[model samples]
Target: MISNAAKAQPRGASRPKGLETAARVRKAALKRFAASGYAAVSMREIAADVGVRPGALYNHFPTKQDILKDLMLSHMADLLQAWDSADFPEKMDPLERFVRFHIRYHLEKTDEVFISYMELRNLEPDNFDLVEAERRRYEAILTGILQDGAARGRYAVTEPKVATRAIIAMLTGIPNWYREGGRLAKHDIEDIYLELARKAVAPGATPPLTGDRMT
Candidate 1:
């Protein structure tokens, strides 16, 4: 279980009103979306949560769907920015850097991470396309890392893209079960996951991945 002492409260109504109304709406929506599925949440409820009348909510987000789109888009953008700024060691192997940086960055953002995965089906078609494109861009970063590692004989990835997806799935699943002070610390968990990831693509783990199996 994550330690209560280490956990930061999810942004909520108690926050100072210094934030712009739109920013407050985004923060409130994130809390509500994570607590209730996107389909079950309504614009009125979000407006109430943010201490605004429903009409005022429209000034910032014309529709509830617009709010959902903004939440998902900003989440992805923040994730990318966090990864870029992570204090990865300059001498670290690309794979090791990726593993550590990913786990550390996401552990601090459980709510955003949860909604990013659980609420995608609620996105409208155009919004879905926009979010998916950003997601693919982030995934491409990992794919490129795997390809580079393979070319250097550091990893035996048979399909860089497939390996990228697999590794991400494994890492992203962390927030589902992790707590701040579980039987293992975050660093210990990161190390264990890193070893599992490293071996999965190690030179002799499995035969070359097939094109059809590139899922």
Candidate 2:
């Protein structure tokens, strides 16, 4: 039998020193890229942000584009993993589960979301294709969900792919204007968007009880 200490540990529990430094580099680069556009940020600036020398930063990432690609790829991977692990009651509406999950996940990852959407132009052609492919994999999840609902007569969606893009655009746009201490709490915003998303697909669905409705 395997010993308790032999059990697999959670991520980052016993990562190597080099990997830890790399993680810091990613975090610093993410903040810098999100604050100023990727073109405006530099390897030296990222090194400064990580409290490491330029050479040390280079040891982990050969180029700024590498860092950006890593960030984007990792973001997509994490999003996919999260959705796979998300728990909801079997009776929950699939669309509702997706809306809530998307809203909540993106809200917590505003910085990653911001850079992922805003910095697509900065990636090199090869890198762009790689990231875009991962993005499509994510989009396909919603498309499949929409198609299933439409087939079940639960959603009135005529074009699952098009509706998938539109719904994602609407959901992902929240971070652009959302503030932590805003008039509406995070859940409040989720409630409103949930209603909008439901109505957009499920004709005649009653609006959610979000007291202050969007005009």
Candidate 3:
């Protein structure tokens, strides 16, 4: 779990203030998305949830589609920015740092990730293409980690791309399945997935990026 102290001040991360109300709309969109999925949500319904008359919503976003597009596009931009700014210590072992990055991401932004993936089909072709490009960029980072670790002999993987997708799918699936006030704590899920991802990418033995010298 991200500490409360870190939430207020992301060192390199900031967003526009006028976006706060629009953010409320996005929050409703996310909940509606989780419950009924995207197609069922309408601009009027979203505006109502935001406590404004339906037409007032157009002042912020011209169309239902526009709001959806902004939700997705902004989400991708925020994610990439956060990822690009994190101070994961380079001195840490490769495999541990790799898993820790994903854990931190999942803990901090799981809802946004879940909403982004689930509502992707709602995007128009051009908009979808834009988000997909950003998604591919993030995927490249993860796959690069896998390939680098494999090359360094710190891990074993037959298919880095496929393995990377599996790990992401497993982690992304958590928001959809996790109960809010239920049995397991959030960190339990985090620890389980970190180890699960390690095993999936390199099973049955210890990963030794720290111990073995890198060639």
Candidate 4:
């Protein structure tokens, strides 16, 4: 069986000395992608930033695209599975459960979501399709939750699917503009997003209908 800390224990995959190097490479990739985006960043530059030779970097990831894909798929899979297996608060209302989700997801997987959203066009078609499908699956979870909340009358969006998409867009936008050391604490940002989401789907939002009501 694989060790609890790792998903699989491949030969030569684990060593204390190399663990630090691998971590550096991963951090460098995330930082580089965050600052410069996927298409403009290169494997050689990433390796240099991590203080490894270009060829040595392949020891951790076979290709630049491979690196991006792994980074994205890990969180995408987690978010997808998380919602499916999630247990919401019994004490809180359904809308509050939705609020809690916005905060938790952004806090845990902000970097991955940032990359997935910004770098889609950089991926080759096949790879992009794989990532996009996972994303769509993740989005479906929110839409499903919204649909359920609407049915229960705890939430009141005219179109559950569109509301779902809007809520996600609004929540995800937090990380884009948020800075770790910025004026607002990270938790505060999460709270703001949660409140915004609650308002978006709050019962009896009255305005002239616009856009696809259901998406």
Candidate 5:
């Protein structure tokens, strides 16, 4: 007979062996892959970091490339899920909403962002296709937003797909040099970038002041 205390001890108290091992493997792999390029990391090193035998690692991930594929796929899938779950203001402009969301999301997952872009060449052809498909799906979200805004005459974008590519490239580059205690706070950076993105497509944006002219 089981007691209430036993049932209420919480799930982590008795986590399944398989799940625990897999999670440790993922953690070790992520750290290794990020610190060193994927090509430089070996299954034995990951297994050693997890305090498991190399052979045991193969039981979970048949090959190191499999682990790399999983990591890449998971990163993109998580980004898509986060975007899907984001709460946007009911009255917020779509472009503004997207700008804030992209900045905040990418900033929070800097390591994942770094690895995803830097390690693409390491992925095999089929794996690359799978990851790229998810990436394009995510990109489509912004493209759709720009297209709708243009159709409503809120934005001056002539090519929604081109605008999407440019905007995403600009936003995703933030994690490269941004630091927590930098001169600008994350919100400040977001505001600046948001305005930049808005003006990039804004209909009838004010012309820049000339050398001798002031607005």
Candidate 6:
């Protein structure tokens, strides 16, 4: 029963005009920044990608630095929010739940992950501090989990904070070589990494050396 005019409106036209344009700008910038380093992408290119005038882009973001800052901070915000809503079972092993959640989330956000790490150097000092604060907040979640697990004799982590960083680096590296339709399914990869992570922190467990046994 919808009228032709209603059907003809572009998708998301119901959103406020300014908000829609800003979303488009962020999307365009994320793609460009992921493909090319943040320092290499320009505001003009982002505006053009969004089908907006360069001057119009300025209305939403006063400068290119603002856009980069927004992208990094937004990524971290989404990450933290996702962890909050992950809804793991009350009885689940905290380390297992965290490993599964982190791997699955980062796999789905490879571009955001790419720019978050690769473009960090391009953020202004003030913006860098803001984003770094969010990063530390996320890291604190894992560190807390590690501390609890160690206290309960469930894990062998000597330094919870250091182990948190090592685990995160290992999990986030999956995106570098992961691809759709790969030899290993996504869940398979998750299981493998989870086992590796488990062994890494298991009491008195020695990690297997490379060329030992992997299938």
Task: Please give the ranking of all candidate structures by lDDT, highest first, separated by commas.
Answer: 6, 2, 5, 1, 4, 3
Best-matching candidate per lDDT: 6
Worst 10-residue stretch by lDDT in candidate 1? 10-19
Q: What is the TM-score of each candidate against the true structure?
A: 0.86, 0.86, 0.74, 0.74, 0.86, 0.88
Per residue, candidate 3 scores C-alpha lDDT tens digits across 1-215 of 88877886664254454367777887887777666777887877888888888887776788777877777888778877877887878787655665566666766666677668878887899988988998888888888988988888767887888987887777777766776678888777767777787776664464555766777
lDDT of each: 0.87, 0.91, 0.75, 0.77, 0.89, 0.91
Clashing pairs in 1: 2-179, 2-180, 2-181, 3-181
RMSD value for candidate 3: 11.7
Q: Which ten residues in a row have the lowest lDDT in candidate 3?
A: 10-19
Q: What's the lDDT for candidate 3?
A: 0.75
Clashes of 5: 0
The predicted structure with the larger TM-score, 4 or 5, is 5
Model 5, stretches more than 4 Å misplaced? Answer: 1-15, 205-215
> Which of 4 and 5 is the better model by lDDT?
5
In candidate 4, which residue ranges exceed 4 Å CA deviation?
1-23, 80-88, 108-110, 180-188, 208-215
Off by over 4 Å in 6: 1-15, 206-215
- Candidate 1 vs candidate 4, lDDT winner: 1
TM-score of 6: 0.88
Model 1 global lDDT (CA atoms, 0 to 1) = 0.87
What are the candidates' C-alpha RMSDs? 10.5, 8.4, 11.7, 6.3, 6.7, 7.6
Candidate 4's residue-wise lDDT over 31-125, tens digit each?
A: 88988888889999999998878999888888998888877787787776776676886787655665567667776777777787888778888
lDDT per residue (tens digit) for residues 51-147 in model 2: 8889998778999999999999999999999999999899998888988999999999999999999999889999999999999999999999999
lDDT of 5 by residue, 1-215 (tens): 99888887766465577678988998899889889989999999998999999999987899998888888889888888988899988899888888999999999888788888899998899989999999999999999999888889888887789999999999999999999998999999999999899989988885654689555
Give the worst 10-residue stretch by lDDT in candidate 6: 7-16
